[model samples]
Target: MELRQMRYFVGVAEELHFGRAAERLYISTPTLSQQIKQLEREVGTTLLIRHSRGVELTPAGQVFLARARETIQAAGLALKDTRRAAGLDEPVLRLGLLNGVPGWLPAALEQLAADRYPSSTVTLAAGTTVDQVRMLSSGEIDLGLVRTPLTLPVATTSEHLADEELGVLLAATHPLAERTELTLDDLAGLELIWIQRAAAPEFYDDALKRLGDQIRLSDISMSHSQLHSALRVRRGAISLGSCRAATPDVVWRPITGRPLVAKYAAIWRTDSHNPVLRSMTVSPGLTAVRQQVVAD
Candidate 1:
């Protein structure tokens, strides 16, 4: 009926001798004997045949003993996970981030990761959100910095950390490149050059869905390479990317009406059994990161 009762039952079942089982449990022989009798009564079946030489399990006892062992093991694991989440007893935190996490976030992230995990090591990574998501799902990493509109399944818990606007990258000589702002309709029929699914699947997929069927999709050679080949070849070619990705070689223009904003989120798989990973905290750091972006 209770975990302690199952534990005592298992101990006595394994030892067979009342004195030995009590010694193993650090309880008196009489206490162990009484508890075993109580357990048998509670189960409505006789658990053991007691004799002066030794104890032997009844048919009911054997079946219940096996199940009791499993229940105790499962309960122990659940307690371990709970303590780990509370940072009472946990391993290191494996953290992953997008390649271009804002500069202002490092100190805050370091503080939180370090303060809460003095005995733990926090490993940080820089990569596409899709790669981080894959790592989290595969148990390669515990946490990820993701950019949304994410289409990943509901099994992942996503916390909105910041908003990164999607901008059009163009050469300085291009018509709208010099303009600080451009509207959604401004890009209606333009020859667009963008990263293919290989460059970054989630980003590319979300971009395609937002841009719709009216625009043509072109391919870039490298899956990991950030360079957009089409944008490089032609002066008028354009690509959609995060504002944080804006570089010196390319000027960014706002997408007038749409003002597309990509949300940066902390994502972790909900189904993960890793206790240390499930204990991660994503609080004030997210707010600080968002504020930094706003202040900038």
Candidate 2:
């Protein structure tokens, strides 16, 4: 139910075709479809009807479309007024972010972005890699700290930053937690953490297939905080991840032979002219991750 979701819906409602709407919005068709589904969930009704010929707005969609447009207009007016009153016309380096970034990164980014261009300020918004891609395409963010590998829209590009072994996560008290390394057979009867597929359909499907080819996952449990809780309380609860979240009760372990790896990259619009944005490396996301891996 974010303004971004509303914006996505408006695009589709106008074009009556997901592909055409996606092109107009600079986002992939799948991403646009996912957002519309989410918006429908929040609104408690189906907004669009899809069939062989084309897409049609449901009765609810027709009503919501009018309101959605009005909301966008009102929001635009509010933003313009606020910007004028605040004299915030100065250049800004807006960066979309993901989880597992180092704790002390934001303060460093503020100074780094400021140093890169004249009178430029840095701003950050947290989202999944899929969300970052959408924000980047729509000009809501100038750059992003995102997980890879993903397809870049024609208007954007990415620079590879770092790679991490897709390793094990479990409670320190778990029987196998003491192992320095793990083999695929070690996960024979273990359950894994759940990832929200709707957030990033491409990555979710690819990653799970990659893992499944090597290991036999019994089932998926909860995610995020709930994931930490399961891993902390149940010795059988296990997951593979590259993120180094500060879960004191949980531990990360390298998989034997490194069957899979996760990657991170900095993404930005190819035609961007913002000096600070052009120079961004997502510094803190990398240095510290590499440092930690080396230390381990």
Candidate 3:
């Protein structure tokens, strides 16, 4: 019956999973379940049916979802109108950029934010995914370009932005360097350059799902410059990253069949209704940003 309950229900309904919805809403799974049960009792009908895989909405739940969304939208508009009548100034925009974020994504988002929030000053912070998640939870930043698989704060949610395709980077003289595309089998006996795991633990964990056990996974602290230096001087040294603009003595090749990807997302507090977040997330600019990233 409460707005919070409606929002919780909507999150669950959209995701069709209690645990995921709980994560997105920044609430415990038990709390979410209790709220939904209370909501169902008030409505005198079952809203969601739990299953082993996840949950599914009933006929009444579907109808309730439509009204709940409308109510939430109207409530947001009423709040905005009241704030405008009171002559409150726009809040400053605090944005966090993940470490090693693709340059073009931040550039496009920053430009869109400037256009939408001209009266509000914009600030940018750079940090790893772990750091950005902490900042988001503490309300230090209003929005962030962060890696996926992050357990966002209770008040926050995330939308996937794009992924960076990671390929093999090797010296031109390496045995596999001449191939247009390489597979996992081609990676044997070569050293892989990797960032420190402490920097982005969740991202590394998510990436582990795709990287099969066939290749030898090494733990090493290698910077981009160090990797480049090693690739130039050592024939067997290699790394996984964006292959754009390789040096004359170095080459990049795609992973055959499937690619290794570094996923990204835009994290923001769900209740903020931030105008700049609204502008890019719902407007055509989101697609434009994706296209720009692809073009780059």
Candidate 1 C-alpha lDDT tens digits along 8-41: 8888888898889889999999988888889888
Q: TM per model?
A: 0.57, 0.61, 0.61
Query: What are the lDDT scores of the predictions, listed in order?
Result: 0.70, 0.72, 0.77
Worst 10 residues of 1 by lDDT: 218-227
Candidate 2 local lDDT, 1-296, one digit each (tens):
78899889989888999999999999999999998998888899899999776699999999999999778867865785577477764477787766554434445555566665657877888887888887787667778867776888997877665566677888888888888888877876567765666556676677777666545454554544466766666667787665464266778887775367766666888787666765554455435434544464
Arranged by TM-score with the best first, the candidates are 2, 3, 1
User: What TM-score should be assigned to candidate 1?
Assistant: 0.57
lDDT comparing candidate 2 with the true structure: 0.72
Candidate 3 deviant stretches above 4 angstroms: 1-91, 223-226, 230-234, 273-296
Better of 1 and 3 by lDDT: 3
Model 1, residue 51: C-alpha shift (Å):
80
Q: Which ten residues in a row have the lowest lDDT in candidate 3?
A: 216-225
Which is superior by TM-score, 1 or 2?
2
Looking at model 3, how many pairs of residues clash? Answer: 1
Query: Comparing 1 and 2 by lDDT, which wins?
Result: 2
